[model samples]
Target: DGVEDDAMIQHAQVFGKPRTPDGRVLERALSARSSKSGKAYREVVKLIIRPPRAEYDVKKLGPTPFTYVRRFRGGKQTVMRTEFAVVNQRQDVELKCSQWKPVGAHLHELPCVLYLHGNASCRLEALQVLKVVLELGCTLCCVDMAGSGLSEGEFVSLGHFEKFDAEAVLHELRSGGRSNGKVALWGRSMGAATALMCTAKLDPLVSCVIADSAFASLPMLVHDLLDEKVGSVLVDACVEINQCVGCS
Candidate 1:
């Protein structure tokens, strides 16, 4: 049993190293030590990989009416709504997307603002700002990130994998001529981090990025959670285990 635990630690060492924004590897906090017991480590890893899924009644936000009226810039304006799907080529997941545009406005005429929802939230979360965006006269688009909403996926990777999902949506918008070539990203919490990560790869194409309440780092977030629940004594051990299991 000792040998098996050691083997798992060695295996995790191969995947736990974090990378800097420039792609440089950062020193691991617990590289030279292993947790005293693997039970807690395993539990933490399980929680990270399979977080609770956020399920809701799609019909409540549904049928995506053909058009909606909103008071924009002191006057009433009619906005057209369209629903569609985009395929995340990286994961082969279909992301459900919704777009709102000013009536009679062509896609090429207005800037597009893509909204990313927080953890445990779906595209419907974007409804909170629908009126504001409409008043700004920008085209608004929102998609259910894989695993979070009506999108296809079994788990959420915070930002690691969701970044690719965002990329796929951007690609669809650009290639499908869905926007005016100027796109902005707005996200909250986990979605905020996803926007930051996704924007790093497509800096030139993005006109602006607004990240709201993003965590400092994944490991730190996990450590804080562990510290709050189990105690600081197990924080390092749990985080170390998290990285080794490729859930970093």
Candidate 2:
């Protein structure tokens, strides 16, 4: 048993180490595959690659964009819970959000669509559906997640951190005594994944979901997005790099 593991470790090391190119030596390392490991070592090899930064300016629509609205409060999130484990205690404030209603719209009666923006997007994206929502005689709501739009954060955690954000928003909606539990979700790209993830976590409250262009997997998304810029080999490298080192 040890002999086989020893062989896998040896093979992994061959690719893990920098081989001086004698042409033949470099070829062997690239072709190298560890027994049972199946390029999980390749996951490690992806670290050196630099990922692109996701950037965009928060929308500056104007002062007091809507009339019917409620402000948010600030507080640390210590007992923050998820479907899995409770994370370590950290200072966190509830996500800032706004709920808009037509003059005639009444709570526990008017239907609403919670809009979740895509990666690198802000709550202003709700405007994209505002017109249709009004036409259908429903209200619109959206929130700013940490690190995107007007939310506070140094970096985006993709959906890992956002799944909780979605949950918090739903809790806010239901607890406010505003929604009659008749709510639907609309998300695009990263938002789409968040919508699906949230619904999987809470399907009863989510009457419907509209997700556009959601990626099957984050790593495959990285590979496909980079495939045109780099060939398949470089794409694999970038994918493995992103996989090993969690990047967006």
Candidate 3:
């Protein structure tokens, strides 16, 4: 009994029990594994909403005057940096943008392909496929999503709120005459989910959508992670506590 009590104390310290709004203990039957499951659920929620900000040298990717000479097009394309502000849920989000376009090409002339980076990543991730995009004869544009990289935001709602950011960027591009009204989306992971969500609403403006490694459902993904952490028996309880805490 003494050893059991000590184990319980250790579990309480490591994985706190779920509580009600008034701080009343809710589930006394919670084992150490169950407590761990609840903790994992909350941690996953925190991670999803506030992922670690990815920082890197923008100069290494390319700033203004960084030109790429096309082999067949017989001209040099340059990368240009731009900034725009988007207001979502009354939060002012300033997006840092970069455009790679052929020299002397008018913005309204070439089709634009907006690249959306994954979670905890910045616009510089587009550098991986920059050459392929350039070869496709389409203008490539990349932006730092809100709550990631240089964008201003306190939280990230994954595809829920990020889709709006993508929409706003597209709107700015078209309305401001920065784009030719022809746009394609290329997104990876979280960005892929955002692209799919945004495309559903703005199918008319989006010429194509290329989603890479997007989750089928966010909730299912969280559930699977929790199951892996603690097992199926505690998954429901953890999910319930997470929902109650408004993390879901």
TM-score per candidate, in order? Answer: 0.77, 0.60, 0.73
Runs of candidate 3 with Cα error greater than 4 angstroms are 1-41, 69-86, 230-248
What lDDT, from 0 to 1, does candidate 2 have?
0.55
Candidate 1: which stretches are off by over 4 Å? 1-43, 62-72, 233-238, 241-248
Give residue 170's error in model 1 in angstroms. 0.7
Q: What digit string (tens of lDDT, one per residue) describes model 2 on residues 39-121?
A: 54343232222112334443343223344222222221111101111111132644656566555446567676888887777
Q: How far is candidate 1 from the true structure (C-alpha RMSD, Å)?
A: 5.6
Error of 3 at 232 (Å): 4.9
Query: Candidate 2: which stretches are off by over 4 Å?
Result: 1-93, 228-248
Residue pair clashes in candidate 3: none
For model 1, how does the per-residue alpha-carbon lDDT over 108-216 read when each residue is reduced to its tens digit? 7788899999887898888888878877878899989987788887656777778888898888777788888888899998889889988886455788998999886
**Per-residue C-alpha lDDT of model 3 across residues 1-248, encoded as one tens digit per residue:** 34533443332333333556553333432343345454554444445556689877677666665677777767766755544555444346777777777667788888889999998888889989887887887878888888888778755666666787888878877887778888899999889988998898655569999999887766566676666765655555444433333333
Q: Candidates ranked by TM-score, best first?
A: 1, 3, 2
Q: The CA-based lDDT of model 3 is what?
A: 0.69
Q: Weakest 10 consecutive residues, lDDT, candidate 2?
A: 77-86
In terms of lDDT, which candidate is stronger, 2 or 3? 3
lDDT of each: 0.72, 0.55, 0.69
Clash tally for model 2:
1
